[model samples]
Every structure is written in C-alpha cells, then in structure tokens.
Target: MKFLLTSGGVTNPSIRSALDGLLDKPVDQCTALCIPTGMYGHPWVGPGVKAWEFVAGKEEGNPMVGLGWRSMGLLELTALPSLPAEGWQPAVRDADVLLFSGGDAVYLSHWVRESGFADLLPELTDTVWLGMSAGSMVTTPRIGQEFVGWQPPGGGDDSTLGLVDFSIFPHLDHPALPTNTLAAAETWATGLGGPAYAIDDDTAIVVTDGGVEVVSEGTWKALAM
Candidate 1:
C-alpha cells in the first residue's frame, strides 16, 4: 500500500506537493480516513467514541484515524468515527484509501483490533493507507510499547495490528508542543531491540513498494532490524 506517514498535518506547500505526488489517483478522487488526535484523551480505552458523537459532533483533524471515508463521504458535520458497533465487516472491508490522523497511539490500536478493522486490513490491498501521528504508530508492529507509555495490564494482551515490522517514536526532540513526553516511549523502544523511526514534528516517512523513504523539511533517522 502507498502511504504518507506524516508527523502531523501537511501544512507546508512542498510537503503538500510531495503528498499529492504520493497519490496514484487524481487529486479530486483522492479520498482518506481521519483518526482524531483528541481520542487519546478519553477516559475509557477502546469501545471508541460515542455513536451519538458521530451523528452530533464535528472532529477537526485527520480522517483515517477518526472516521472511515465518511468525512470525504456524504456526512456533513460529524463526530469521530468509532468502530461500528454493528461491526466493520462491511465498511472497512472495501475502503479505497485510509488516512489516520494524529492521536493517542494506544487508543487507535485498541479500537482497530477491537473493531476488527485490523483483521480486515489485509483484504483492502487496493486501498492506500496513510497515517499521521498515532495513526502512523499503529501501522507498525507494536505501537503501545513505542508510542504509548503505559504497559500491558497484569495479564491482559496488548498485541498490535502488525502492519510494519518497525516501531515509531513520535514527538521526540521536537520543537513544537511542549507538553509531549519522549522519555517513556523512547526508553521503551531502546530496549525492544527493534528498529525505531525517530521523527521530528516536521518530518514524514513515505512508504511504497520501492521502500520506506524519509522525506521532510528536516532530518530523520531509521533504526533498522
């Protein structure tokens, strides 16, 4: 799948051009899924956003991680798209393209697995998968370890969606947000012996059948397996 694994939003012109270039489709038909960065702040973990919210609220961020294609779809004003209680058996089954927004890595991962989207991902080979922050983390083998600071419960499981073999370390050594924490996630990745992709807030990791290419306004380092 093609990916625009951005650190955050593509606010830069050069970045936008680069993003546009990533698409195999024309710009007008380019659709995406937004996952909200705000969902991380919720008290409970995965059952996901309240269904009423989708009908009554408006999330102001990315798509893949937030809702499915509904944002770029028919919905006018909507809330964060949680896993369909009825099941993602149909919707996620045929997504053409997905865009995950920045948010809590743990929450997104939990929802993906709980919602059963993770299992169906392999079916959507025709779809392009793009993730922002937390969205990006979940694409990797294990997001809870490298992105989320909290550990697995005493006996409960914390398995990931396992898209990529690498782990992502976000908001580290960046100049933007002062509230983000690096130590917890950083220390975790260091011990895993897995490759870590360290990205500043301005950078991005572009993936294709060719390879995972680092592209952005600054520097990016990849710790390989």
Candidate 2:
C-alpha cells in the first residue's frame, strides 16, 4: 500500500491531488481505506466512512456522509452509545482504502482496540494509507511525544497500526501545542533506533514503498532511532 501521511487535516485543498497520486487509481480505487479522524468521536467518522462507501456503491448506513466530516474526537467514542456486538471490524474488513484525520490519537487507539478494528487493519499495508494529525502519529510503530506524558490523562499505550517505523511529534511548535516534543521524540528515536519525523500543521511527510518525502509549507526535522 502507498501512504500520504500529514501532520494535520488537509487544510490546503490542493494537497488532495497529491493524495490521489499515491493511489494506483480509478480501477484500483476499491482498495482505498480512510482511517477515521480521531476527533469529534465517531460522530465525525460517520461521514468520511460514508463518502467512501457511497463512492464504492455500498450505501450501508452511517451518518456524516455528505454533511462534511466533523473534527471527530477520538475520545468522543467512549461516550457514544454502544455499538452492535458485531462491532466495527466487519465493515472495516470489507473496505480497502483507509483515510485518517487529525484529532485525539489516544482516543483513536482505544476505538481501534475496543471496536476490534485493530486486528483487521494490518493487511492494509498493500492498500492506500492516509493520515492527518493523530492519524499520522498512530501509523508509526510507537506514537511520539504525545504518548510521553501519557497516563490516564494522555491515554495509555499508544499502540498504532504500525504502518510506519517512525513516530511523529505532530503540530509541534503550533500555538495550540507550542512546546516542541523534541526530547520525547528523540527518546523514542533512540529507543527504537529507527527514525522519527516531527512536523508542523503546514507540513506533511509522505511515505511510500520507495521512500519518505516531505510535502507542505514548512521544513521538518527527522531523527534516526
């Protein structure tokens, strides 16, 4: 699978073109899967999932398809009413492309686990992988700085889908998250001894079978784990 990972949601509309390039295209579009943005809880996810399902001609039944996806907070799922016992994994298995959006990484991880989506996501490596902020962070084997202070507050065990070898300190230096998590990112890099990427909202780190590239408006820093 090819990947278009970003620090935040696709603020620059033009970036969608860049994202399309990652896919094999029209014929192979069935293989695409969009990861749920970990904000607004599942309320936001209803639509993103709906869009793809609509395009795919599935037409199951999930809200948010045309209403414009909300900033679905990952933690929001915890408060949502219970899902069917069959759970989310069934739908996930039937899909191909996975799109991820920015939000709370901690809550997103939990939903994957509790919803049984975690086990179903591994084979997606051959499919298209798209991520925003928290979505991008969860792609790495170990999520970066956000998980450093993780506890009950930061959410525990930042277990991502492991699509990438590195972690990310997303939105670093942004007014919303001004403090740079260099220390935490470096610590993860050193421990894993692989490589980690740090990005701001204006930047994106694109990864493919070939290599990793930086795309966006700003410079990014990477460290070898």
Candidate 3:
C-alpha cells in the first residue's frame, strides 16, 4: 500500500513531487476522487444551512484544484449514504488517487466504516491514499484526545482504519489549529503506546510498501513515544 499523509493538502513543491512520484505518471493523466466527508463533522456557523452545504461553502479556495491532476471528482459519502458499493466502486477503481480532505477525524472514521470504504481500501492496491489533517489522522488505530480537543460522539469504537501502525498529529504550531501546538503534540505522544508523528502544513509522510519517508519544505518530527 502507498500513502501520502499531509497536515495540509499539497501545500508545497516537495510534497507535489512526492505525490507525482507515487502516481508514477504525468499529472495530466491521473484522476483523483476527492472525499470531503470529514468536513461535515466540523462545527457549523450559520443556522439554517445543511451541514454539508455549510462545510462545502467553507472550502472555496481549496488547494487541491491546483495540484494538476487530470480530473478531480467530489464524492460526499454523507450525502449519498444509500448509494450502493457498485455505484462508487467504479469511481474508486478508476481513480489513480483517493484524496481525503481535512476536518474532524472521528467523523471521518465513522463514515469510512459505515460506508464500507474501510473494507474496500485494502483491495485498492494501485490507488495511492492521500490525506490532509484529520484525513491523515483517520488512517491510524486511534486519534489521541489532545489532537481534537474533545471525545468523539458515542465514545464507542473510536478506533480508525489502522492502515498505518503509528498515529499522526497534524497542523502542529498552526495558528488556526491552536489545539495542535507542538507542546500538545508532545503530551499526546507521551501517552501513545507506539510511535507517532507531528507535522506542520508543508510536511508529509510518505509510506511505500512498508518503508517511510518524510518529504518536507517545512517541519516535522517523529515521536519516540
């Protein structure tokens, strides 16, 4: 399996090159499926609008558009929960990459399991799994409480897909994500039973076949926890 896990989506040149290398094809020839389900879990501002709409409106200038993929298709699992696997499997199979946008990790994890995408992932060997923020966090066995500042709803099965053995804390030191400071990351890391990583916007951790590489234009650190 291959993974391009980032704190922010394709934020710098090094990450872009890493993504291109993972695809092993010209950018114009690769197709991507954008999964924005995670955004729905975020807190909404306005009163009347639906959650999905509220989240969609906030992503007006997403950086994914400039990544130069041949085509990018939006797939909102929450909006189409009833759609059969057959309806979406073809899109997953055809795409060269699965782009998961940032938002609430627990919400994304819940949907991945409920929508059956978690089961489908292991089978998609040829498609690279690309994630940003909470998108990257959901691939691990568990998302630390300090990372999100609150417990997941229902408090049951908070475990994620466990696609990777270690956990990830994104947006470290980002002013917008104040809860994810480097000091908080260190605290989170101390409680982890295994390894973890703290990354800023311009860094990414690329995993290929079982080996890991850090591709960055900014900062990142591997937690010895």
Number of backbone collisions per candidate: 13, 27, 0
Quote model 2's TM-score: 0.63
Tens digit of per-residue lDDT, candidate 2, span 1-225: 677677754545434555656655542334433444364343433446643453333333211112132221122234323765355444445444466655566667666666555565565565655676676776777775445322345456655667677777776667655456666556656765467787776677778878887777764678883
lDDT, candidate 3, 73-180, per-residue tens: 877766556897788878877888887877778888888877777777877887898888888988988787654532456665446778888999887788766787
What lDDT does candidate 1 reach at residue 12?
A: 50
What tens-digit string does per-residue lDDT give for candidate 1 at 1-225? 666676654535555666667666554555544344324433432226632232222433322323323335321111324535344345444445665655556556666655445666666766676666666776776654334543334533334556776777666566555534455555666665677776765677777767777776755566444
- Per-model TM-score, in order, reads 0.68, 0.63, 0.87
Top of the candidates by lDDT: 3
- The 10-residue segment of model 3 with minimum total lDDT is 45-54
Error of 1 at 7 (Å): 1.5
Q: lDDT of each prediction vs. the true structure?
A: 0.55, 0.56, 0.77
lDDT of 1: 0.55
Error of 1 at 171 (Å): 2.4
Off by over 4 Å in 2: 26-37, 40-96, 145-159, 181-193
Which candidate order results from sorting by TM-score in descending order?
Answer: 3, 1, 2
Give per-residue lDDT, candidate 3, residue 220. 83
